[model samples]
Target: MLSFVVRRVVAAFGTLLLSSVLVFLAVQSLPGDVATQVLGKDATPTAVAALRDKLHLDQPAWERYLEWVKGALHGDFGTSLVNAKPVGGEVGQYLGNSALIAVVTVLFAVTGSLVLGIIAGLYRDRWPDHLISTVSLIGMSVPEFVVATVLVLLFSIAVPVLPAVVLYGPDASVGQLLPAVWLPAASLAIVMAAYIVRMARTSVIDVMAGEYVTTARLKGLSTWRVVTRHALPGALLPTLHVIALNVAWLVGGVAVVENVFNYPGIGKLMLSSVQNRDLPVIQAIALISAVVYVCCNLAADLGAMALNPKLRTRGGRTR
Candidate 1:
């Protein structure tokens, strides 16, 4: 188990390094000059050139990349091209905001999906199963923007209960964030729930059909007992993997939802960076998201191994 974990961590680090390089290259290729963005449209050629030189934009790409890489190794992501603020500090702040929203969404989505999927699977081909399947399909079919808009219209405009847009202050508390957080979180949750529900339902159905499960039922165990004791444990393993992937996906997927609700998150920061051609901020955010994704997947793999004894062995196979 230790060796497996070590190998996974090592591979995740390698993937993060490669992704950082790709993110840097991709951000570097984006159109527009950061110097021009910094100076403004009316800035003279000489002024822009001098500003570029000051920002070291005049250096070769490889040289700049190496410097940035070196700084990153020391926990510095370099300074933002537009604001001259530390990228690491800025990203850290935004990451917290993004993580809060994503975590809330995941908790709600995962819990609801698990219950719904289990009930649906247990009552397969029945009304409960049909209802869950239909709802999940509808949830999956809608885009986040549409869902966000509907939520805002229903809850904000018509009901006047929650705020439509997220407002962030210097010292925003959880109470202050709730109105802003709920809509985007709900928007993300609705979509994410669909995936979790489907995976959970399938896993439950597969587990319930196993010989061991049949034997347990033949022993005259109560329905709930059979599910909770004999079936749920194994059924949950596949859902754990799906949940991990969704958590990673939330890092990127929240961008559109954030935009819809005017939320202040890494997603919004990345969008603004693109609009302003802020290469440093863009690259930093992309790399951070990549790291989050890689780490989440690593955690998922580890969790699966921990839950299933067969997966812990060196020669055993795991689905």
Candidate 2:
């Protein structure tokens, strides 16, 4: 297990390195000059040229990339082109806000989906199953922005129970934080819960039909015990994969939801960076997001292997 974990960690690092290069190249290829964009349209060619020189934009692309790579190795993501603030520092602030929202969203999504999915799977052709399936389909069909708007309208504008938008302050308390983040988190959770429910339902169904489930049932185990211990454990492998993939998705896909709710998160930061043509911030956020995606997937693989003895044996043989 130790060797397996070490191997995965090494591979994850390599994947992150390659992903960072790709992200850098992709951001660089976008239209417009960062220096000119920052300076303004009225800036003269000579002024733009001087600004580029100061920003090292006049250097060869390969040289610029090398410099950025070296700085990144030392935990310096360079300075934001627009604000001149450290990109790492800016990202840290946004990441904290985003992480809080993402954690709450995942918690709600996982809990709600698992309960509904298990009920639906157990009841298969019954009324509860149909009700859950219908709800899941509706949740899946609607876009997150639409959901966010509806939530804001119902809970914020009409009822005025929760605040219409998230407000961050230096002195914000934990009690105030919940109301601030709840709307956006709920919007994200609703969308993600549908996918989780569908995946869990299918996995549960597959596991319930397996021979081991029947053996457990025949051994005089209660239906609940048989389902939870014998079937649910086997079903969780696929659900775990879905959860891991969604964690990465939530980080990047929260842009629309964040924008709607006016929540401060990395997604919103990335969107603003694109609009402002802030290349450093854009590149840094994209690289961090890509690394997060790769690491989440690696962690999921390791976790699944750890949970399933069969996978551990397979991994050993492959190694």
Candidate 3:
């Protein structure tokens, strides 16, 4: 188990290193000049050259990458060329707001998915199963933006219950944030739940058909106990992997949902930076997203190993 965890951590670090290289190269390849975006297009070549020199855009690619990596190791992501602000400080604020929304969405999604999935699996081929299946399909079919738009129209425009745009102040309380957060969170939750429900339902149904489940049932265990204890534990392992992937998506890929609701988040910030050709902010957010993805995947693998000891190995191979 110790060796397994060590291997996974090392691999995760390697993945992050590779991801940073790729993200840097990809961002550098984007059309348009950073200096031009920072200063207007009307700015003369001399002014653009001076700005590029100041921001180190004049440096060689290899030299700049090395400097950036060195600074990143020291928690210095460099200053934003456009805003002239510390990249770390600005990204930190955006990350906090994004995390708040993502966490709430995940909580709602996982809980709802688990319940709906278990019910659908237990009542396989019944109306309950059919209903859940249909809902899951619909959830998967609709795009998040459409869902966000409809939500705004129904709740914000028609009913006027929830706030249309998310504009949370620094001093805002949880209750104050909820109305602003609901539409975005719900948009994410609905889409995420589709995958979870399908995975959970399939896992539970398969587990119920296993010989161990039959033995438990034959031993006079009650229905709920047999399902909850004997089945749910095994069923949840696969569901957990799906949940981890969705968590990663929530972190980095909620751009459309966030934009639709005008929610201040890392995704929206990254998009804005892309448009403004702000390399520091864009690179910082990309690196953060990659790190989050690698870390979440590592956590998922660890959780799976803990839940199923049979997957652990004394040697290089699982027993």
Candidate 4:
């Protein structure tokens, strides 16, 4: 287990490094110049040159990338062009907010998916299965932004049950935060639950078809016992992969949803940075997001291996 974990950790670090290179290259290759965006259109050529020199943009691309990589390793993500504040500091605040929402969304999604999926699988070909499948399909079909808009229209505009925007305004309290955050969280949860439900349902069905499940049933185990005890554990291994992928997607892919709802998250922050051509902020957020994705995938792989004796034995044989 220790060797497995170490290998996964090393792989995750390599993934993060490669992601940083890709993000840096992509940001550098963007059409507009960061210096131009930092300075207004009215700025003279000499002024733009000065700004570029100051930002080290006048240097070769490889040199700039090396400096940025060094700074990033030292936890210095550079200063934001727009705000002149440390990019890491600004990203940290938004990351905290985004992490909270992501955690809550994942919790709701996993729980809801597991419950619905178990029922659907246990009653395969029955009404419960049909209903769950239909609901999951609908949830997956509709985009999160559309869901956020509908939620805002129904809950905020019409009924006034929750606030349309989630960012805490001046003088906002904990009481005020709940109603504000509820819609965005719900929007994310709804989209995530769809994937989870489908994955869980498929896993459960596959597990149920295995000989061990039949043996458990033949041993006179109760239906629930056979499903939950014998099947659920095996079923969960596959579901872990889906959950990990969704968690990573939620980390960065929440941009549209965050923008629609005006929620302050890492995704929305990245969007704003891109619009303004804020390279430091954009690169920092991208690197952080990539780290999150790689780590989540590693965790999922480890979890799946841990839960399956067959996988553990296979690893041992390979070793």
**What lDDT score is found at residue 60 in candidate 2?**
90
- Write model 3 residue lDDT over 1-319, tens digit each, in one string: 7888888889999999999899889988888888888899799999999988987887898888999999998889999877788999888887887778888898999999999999999999999999999999999899888889999999999999988997764334567666788889999999999999999999999999999999999999999999888899899899888988988888655888888887777888888887887888989998998998998899888888887767686722477
Displacement of residue 128 (Cα, Å) in model 1 is 0.6
lDDT of 2: 0.85
The residue ranges of model 2 lying beyond 4 angstroms of the native Cα positions read 169-176, 314-319
Largest TM-score belongs to which candidate?
A: 3
Pick the winner on TM-score between candidates 1 and 4: 4
- The Cα error of candidate 4 at residue 278, in Å, is 0.7
> Residue 278's C-alpha lDDT in candidate 1?
75
User: What overall lDDT, based on C-alpha atoms, would model 1 receive against the true structure?
Assistant: 0.86
What do the candidate models score in CA lDDT, each in turn? Answer: 0.86, 0.85, 0.87, 0.84
The TM-score, computed over Cα atoms with residue i paired to residue i, of candidate 4 is 0.93
Candidate 1, 125-243: lDDT as tens digits: 99999999999999999988899999999999999998998777424666777768988999999999998999999999999999999999899998899899889989998998898
How many residue pairs clash per model? 0, 0, 0, 0
TM-scores of the candidates are: 0.93, 0.94, 0.95, 0.93
Which residues of candidate 3, in runs, are more than 4 Å off? 168-176
In candidate 3, which residue pairs clash?
A: none
